[model samples]
Target: MSLITCSKGHQNPEGSRFCTLCGEPLPEHNAFAGGINTGLVEGTRLRDRYMIKYQLGQGGFGRTYLAEDTGRFNELIVLKELMPTGQGTYALQKAEELFQREAAILHKLRHPQIPKFWELFRDRKGLFLVQDYIEGKTYQDLLNNRLDNGQSFSEVEIIELLQQLLPVLSYLHKQGVIHRDISPDNVIRKEQDGLPILIDFGGVKQTAIDVATQLAAEKYGGSGTRLGKSGYAPDEQLRLGSVAPHSDLYALGVTAIVLMTGKPPQELFDAHTMSWVWNRQLNLSSDFNKILQRMLAQRPSERFQSAEEILQQLPAVSTVPETRVQPHLTQRQITSSNNNFIPPSPAPINTSGQGHLLDNSVEVPDEIVGWNWGAFLLPGFWCLTNRVWIGLLSWLDLSVVTLGIPTITISILLGLKGNEWAWKSRKWKSVKAFKRHQRFWAIAAFILWALFLIIIIGVILFAIAIAGFGM
Candidate 1:
């Protein structure tokens, strides 16, 4: 005998509160009460606008519908109706409160990545939240096609995808909004622009103390409770109680891992042990692997503190150092001013849109680009230094010079290349004349080499003097 039945009078889960025909919300009774068909009735409009069109989707606690706004003007929005999860009447009250909280949270957030909130309405049907209707397919759709086609994305492609989301997360975290649910299902990749849009605010938690106070929040989505998807939730998120930004980072790490390996992280990584799958074909670089490992750390504190900090380490998507601007002075100021600044009124500097000033006359420094010169040469600086030191300390000076000189030169070039990153990061604060002073360092290096040779010769002469007595 069928005990549990849906609104269409069809057997369903015990105490189901949804329709079997359309999956619409049924009357509230109890947690395990049978669903009831209230018969179709036009819901009462709230604030004299937002006419309910039809049901779009329904969950255990709420029903979403496509609605038209008539109060201010005719605007299209998806209205989520907060309905009771079970047949219990108390469930209706609790669901209404949750829906209101969701509305308040949504209204506070405004980001390019998140959907825009339209309005919140409550009337005969129940509490409803209207939000932007993003026209696009979810990330799940892309992942599905990727699996079907046996598709693989390059590191650069993955970076481009994350470049959009990381900044979004940074903004959200700064605003104290923790997006507890971040998975392919919630991410919408637009066909027109090919950018991922984060949706589904029902699971979003506002950490802002002031705004959070307005809406009485019950138990938060914490770790150990397994609020989010199994593989994606961080150690902290599964516990339950308090949620943090790193919880989202854990999900992001899982998302990237899945995208790269073409398998859910659960299949590859054991959250309990934090171990990768048995010898999966690894095509990614060691650096990327290290990044994922850090983000998916068992401890929240061990993960990258913030999205901004994580972006700093990623070479592919990091922001280049802004170019420094040279201040443009009037002819009068340049010609006059005692050849230097003499005026009490200083000339204004404009750096609105400019790159770093460069000395066109001199060649670009090697430090800006990491170009290893010694890779082509055998027996590098260390080899050269050993030969010189061993020869001078002993008696084989000629043999040492022959082995060491070329290696030393190659090592110098490599050192310059290695130092380029540091040099480029530094803003050239010096004027043109100061820029020319860099040549002095080159001259100094040669002078130091000459000095080393002189010492070696002096040492040889002293040894010869001692040998003369034996002769």
Candidate 2:
């Protein structure tokens, strides 16, 4: 086979479109040169080392290209260009300064969840920034795929995502960098480890804001443009042009809700009432629901003060209580509060051949009152064991709404009224019979609860494995 050397000087087999080591496309010797006059073309070598293969994306501030580092054996890298549109000489200078500042911030960040910054340079084309190219799909792509498949993220999945990503946010906050833009599009879930990587810092918008302020101080500015997603950005950030760490939290909260409901933030938010109406679409654990609500609060003061505070409020999956069977109570005469059932008094009954009266009375124990822990802890199993059809249906309904999160209130109510429902469901000949049946079912309920827990754990592990495999 014949050999061809790529622009990065990597020799490869003939007819290869891209370099094996660096992913740079090999230029065709007989290819025509006529193309769009953007100054950048296929196989264009920049800085005498980096080779641009193709453009990745473009925004208001700049264009991004997938390039290869010839110095590093054609290793893949991203080159971002600072091509400010319709800006004059003075504005362009400010933009360049902002770009440099962004580069400095990126250099200071040292987290596995963030992309590594390489170097900043300026050429005849424009200002350029070289950085590591992460291999993965954005969260927005993942969400869209799920929506296309007629499925959405479950509460547990969203919670796990938040748990995994919040620490990165906390790390950034401690370093004095507020990620002004934190929408789903900005978060990439790496294919190898299923870890999220935050990308696309708001450098361009920040630069614009700085320029606007500077010009305004000199009486040459009109109005500064806002720099965040409309639905995800809080009022303070969107209206007042003030951003804080908590601002990122608001966007994260909106992202979670969007993932959970498979609906846009605009649809979920009610501008008339100035509150989110997402609660009606999904059911979530009380703690999680409260945390998201506070995070999405209209006022930043009403939200969590820090990421650590939000972490503390997240639900712990390992704290699920082990099911315990309650002890059976033997025959005892009972008095009803709403009914006039007379309590049995002490009576003597005789024994032996002659008809005799012996003590047939037993002390009545204190009434079982208040909440029932068994029902509260294991609602589905508790209902199934007790054969409460209504309870089972209610639990199933709630599970569907909350994306399979068990309803604590329903569980608690079941625990409080479980015994009463059991007694009313069947006709018992004596108190001893009722006690025997109740004890048997209690043991059965515990067994069912154990099986339920095992199944849930297995499903979670399976999901994690699939996610790790990028399936």
Top model number, TM-score: 2
State each model's CA lDDT, in order: 0.54, 0.67
TM-score of each: 0.54, 0.59
lDDT (Cα, tens digit) per residue for candidate 1, span 276-328: 55125445555665777788777777888899877877744222222112223
lDDT of 2 by residue, 249-340 (tens): 99899999888777778889888898899887877777788999999998888988789998888875322122111111212312234444
Q: Worst 10-residue stretch by lDDT in candidate 2?
A: 348-357
lDDT of 1 at 165: 91
**Weakest lDDT window of 10 consecutive positions for candidate 1:** 345-354
The global Cα lDDT (0 to 1) of model 2 is 0.67
Model 1 misses residue 46 by how many Å?
Answer: 6.5
